[model samples]
Target: MRRLASGPDILLLAAVWIVDVAVFSTLLNRSDSPSGLLRAPVVVGYAAVGAAALLLRRSHPVWVFAAVWLHSCAANLLPLGVHPTAGVLVALYTVTASRGEAVGALAMVAGFVPLGLTVAAEVRAAAADERITILTANAIFFTVVGLLVWGLGRWVRANREHARELERRRLAEADAAVAVERRRIARELHDIVAHAVTVMVLQAGGAQQILGTDAARALRTLRQIEDLGREAMGELRRLLLVLRPSAGDEAQQPVDGHQPGLDDVDRLVGTFREASLPVRLGVCGAARRMDRSTDLTAYRVVQEALTNVMKHAGPGTRTRVELNWADALSIRVTDDGGSPPRRASAPSAGHGLLGLQERVDVVGGTLTAGPTRDGGFEVNAALPVPTTEPDRARSGG
Candidate 1:
């Protein structure tokens, strides 16, 4: 609530004052009686004060209503008779609009009290025949107008509350969308950087061991490292574009030519094998077409699982990856326990499984990873595939 009146409040006060003064002057003009003319200035002065009270109606609705009520009663009791004035009705509207139903109901009854008393006084002073008619008409008219004004105020209050509720809902939805996007960006960073760095470390170590005895093999390993490094840089550039892209780059391709999916799993396994981590790939059932998100999630599950084996397992550890295409695509990557590494295991930040779970969830899949009974580790995932698409096209078919 405002402590001081606003522009609209001043305008409303001016409008009501003009209306009240005009009506009072018109009644005074029609009556040529000397007593009515003498009281004219006093009535206008009191009406001015009531209209001015409207300025503070929003801040002090109850008090404003009381002042206006007194002004209306004085008009009737002082023999310059007027029905309940516009000031009293405006005050009633403010009370109901600002203070709500229970308080507004009280204000309505308070407003009618003075009018009732003035009417009863007039009926007693009049002739016996005219008393009943005056009482009935005034009572009916005033009650109906009072209820309509109160109801209009309540309608305005309800509309304001409804608008506020819609604004709150819109803000909440925006916040939730921001949180989800941050998690997705975090997941992408972990998957791309972690896997590439792990492969490079193993390749570097393998090259160092054979550098002097077999120069040719060392050279080949270094070339693979150079190629892998370039690929990682390209992927990072693509991810960066997603984070903060220039207008020109909006039409550019994502990273290299095409995004990696299930079809690229074989090449992914080949990359790990080149780094001296023994890997074998197997497939069963006819592969079916999948949506982009589900295809990418399936590939990532295998990539993350194999990357984990290289990071935490021994040097001679062997990994097997299986893809079972069915109504739902089922994937499994298992690593056989091997001789302990000659050096300390690589450091782990442990975001692999956590990110994998979130990615799998996005595509409506389930992922589980744990040590097997045979002293090996295994990651298993089942991703649902939409059957409404064409069968996956195989090369040279």
Candidate 2:
């Protein structure tokens, strides 16, 4: 940082100051031949003060103004330099860029007072026997410069404040979006694992009633229920982790590995099949591979769609699951006919589609669910295939 601060970049601004002094000194000499008061050493002193003011311009804007004021008074009184006020202009610019409005305003008034006095004194002395036009002109110039400096400072501060405000608003919007995503995720867990576990417990009990005659089959059914409970817990843990990366005691671990893919669809469809629901599963296009997140989303979308079917369309409904892996992966689940054999004990359990919609949105995909013309419920979903490794890497990474 020290090296950067001391680097040659600042020499450019220093050079401009030096050039201004040389030209103005030449003009002063041309306009007023060496009145013995205008000596080389005195002119050099004025330049030294102006250069020093420029050196600490950013760090000490008020000090720069003070130094330039002293130099300006000397130059103008003897008219030793034609451009007496350029160093003051530089100081004004420094205050504009760095200082706050109230402080800059104080510095402006402080600088203008001494400056106007010096010009007024010079005018009184130089135009002793002349009209007062020169004095009025000098006063007007001082007032204009004071107003200009104050205006510049105000403008810069306003712009800086506006930029900061915009940044704050943008961050607020991002936080709100994340909060909304978390709420939707919570709702999905309530419907999926919570409902699935309840159904599994009930199914396991039913299997036990005929346990003696079909003892082996009953055990197999019990095991399937245990497997499902574990699966739901695993999915639940993963969803919790994704929602809360920083969750500690509250942290629910993410499902460690990727979400199950097309291969796992068979296992999912088989769960209902074992329960004696007629389920037809279909696949099209290449069974393209994908990241775990999309697989999870696909899993959840299918899971919720099916869950809704069983909840609303009822038990013994014929369900069809289709996976199309063409340009993008598409999932469709249709219940051509199945109203719960009996009305469900719970009627409000069909709201899982809200969670499904959020899952699809996270992947920049889309999902839609509604009744079909053929007297069935249909869920049609399309998830964009992450076409490149970079995109997949970003989501996975």
Candidate 3:
């Protein structure tokens, strides 16, 4: 069944039919030819059928075009005293807009042929006094009008396709950004949990061994384990809170009310000290403040390096963390002990290192990790310290 026309479609159909009736009535009434007067009803009926086809032009453009084209040819062949109807023009525009240039070009040719033929017939029947002038003017007028309608329809189709292409590209870019952010969050979560758990395990092992011989020291180790667990939980909460959409004032403060930075290195080293891993922190050149991202990257690099030392190098390993502040901030974590046996269930050796490399790359830095010449392992990174014009002015250098 044909779907019902909308209010706008109905209005359009009524308007086109009214215009066709008015134009045909005026033309037929003014004509002196008996044959034209006799064909008046036939012309009106064909015009009405063509006007009704306009209702479905947008939904079924090709069918509407076919119907209107046939009507136009019939009206022309009958030699009715009428011009190209409004319905024919509407159908031509719909076809070009819906079907592209190739089909549009064909419709234009098919539509204009009958119009040209009717004009030629009219020109031949006219008195010889003004035949050439009338033929030239009418031919120019009709051709220009037809081309304009067809061009306008093609332009609308091109614009619509351009807009759709832009929308598709925008959606693709948004999806890519989301995937990158998720990967970053995953790296952070892995680093936080893995490092904290490694420390807790070492502390727990120490506490178990010395529980009877030195109850106080073992108790201290147990307390350190508890602290590490709390810290990890706080960091995880903060990270998760950062993922949520912020509302007003709640988003400004860190969820755990702490932002880890280079200053936290001493406290971080203290935990490993308690676990009996001697971590010596060495600072070279003057220390200066860094932006939060670079600062966090620096801290995470050390944290992951030390965690690896604890996991692979085992206890009693002498680890060194050196920070060199210059045009760039350099971090070096080294352990003198060679690689020890890692547990079968431990994470792959490359996972943590790969995560660290990604973090460094994000901050436009470089990282290198391998066995050192002294039969040990080392992880080193150089992170650039961003300096703005304000800093240069403040320092007066």
Candidate 4:
């Protein structure tokens, strides 16, 4: 019932009914001819039916327009005389609003025929001087009113379509952004877990090999493995915290607590040395504090390159990690060790290089990783340094 007659529907129905009553009353009071009086009841009944048809206009706009239009024409044809009612205009607006431009044009043309005919009838009954005046005035008045109503409906329909199109574009952009962010998060997780576990594996293997021959060294290796495990767990927890929504006191804690930066690269190198890899670190040019993101990317590049060396170059490889700080930071990790040793659980997804490339690109940097001419592998990256106000002031314009 509510769908059939909403609040606006009831109000429209009442308005149309009132217009019908007013038109009928005016016809009865204005005319004095006996023939006109006799036809008055028929015209009044026709107007009532046309106005009632407005109730279904929203559901069947074209059909309602045709029905109301035919009834209006029949009423006008009667000798008694009838005037244009609100029902005709209402039906015309509904057709234009719902049926689009092509059908609305047809309805407009159909409506014009009756109006022209009514004007012609009025002209035939007037004196010669008044005939021309009445014809011109009625033609101009009806044409202007009809076109205004039709144009208003078309304008409203166009605005509604435009709004819907904007909403669709907004939702599509949002979905694309979400997909890109998911890929980024996946890459970050891979880098963190892969590097940490690889070191742990090397330490465990060293502990196993030296257990019978050297008890003190084996125990030291085991302790190192425990420390690596605890560090990995802490990093994993931080990553997980980002996914969970916080409440109360937890909300105040930072999501990233002491994220690794360039300063931590020395510590990272120490861990690899403990795993029995002979690694060298070289720094050239002056070192200065860099932006958080650039610092993080530089650290990850070194970390990933060293991890790859551990996996592919095997133990006892002479590896070199170089950091050249100039206009941009240049990182290169190279190993003299040959092919990788086969292992049962050598964690591989083939996404390590790809993830490194993505991280480099995000900081407007470039990364190159492939075999070197020396029968070894090399990973090189160049990351741009972000300028700060202090640097600008010191350099001078």
Task: Identify the leading candidate in terms of lDDT.
Answer: 3
Off by over 4 Å in 2: 2-27, 30-38, 41-45, 55-84, 121-131, 242-397
The models' CA-based lDDT, in order, is: 0.72, 0.65, 0.73, 0.71
TM-score for each of the candidates = 0.50, 0.55, 0.52, 0.50
Better of 1 and 4 by TM-score: 4
State the lDDT of candidate 3 residue by residue for 224-343, as single tens digits. Answer: 999888767755654553353322211122367355778788888889989999889888766665545556779889988999888777788888999887788899998886345333
lDDT of 1 by residue, 1-397 (tens): 5457778878888778767666633345545777767666765676677788788787888988998888777766666544336788899988888886799889878878765765665576568999899788867876888889888889988888889899897655544443444345444644665677789999999999999999999999999899778757755654553353212111112365355788888788888888898888888777787655567778879988988888778556988888887788899998875564322224232456655676676556898877776667888999988675547643210
Best by TM-score: 2
User: Clashing pairs in model 1?
Assistant: none
Q: What shift in Å separates residue 154 of candidate 1 from its native position after superposition?
A: 1.2
Answer with 1 or 4, whichever has the higher lDDT. Answer: 1
Off by over 4 Å in 3: 1-5, 24-41, 79-84, 213-397
- Residue 309, candidate 4: Cα error in Å is 43
Model 4 misses residue 167 by how many Å? Answer: 1.6
How well is each residue in 130-249 modelled by candidate 2, as lDDT tens digits?
537767777788778777866887788788889999989866654445455555455455456676688798888879786989988888888889877776775577566446532112
Candidate order by lDDT, highest to lowest?
A: 3, 1, 4, 2
The regions of model 4 sitting more than 4 angstroms off are 20-26, 30-41, 78-85, 121-129, 210-397
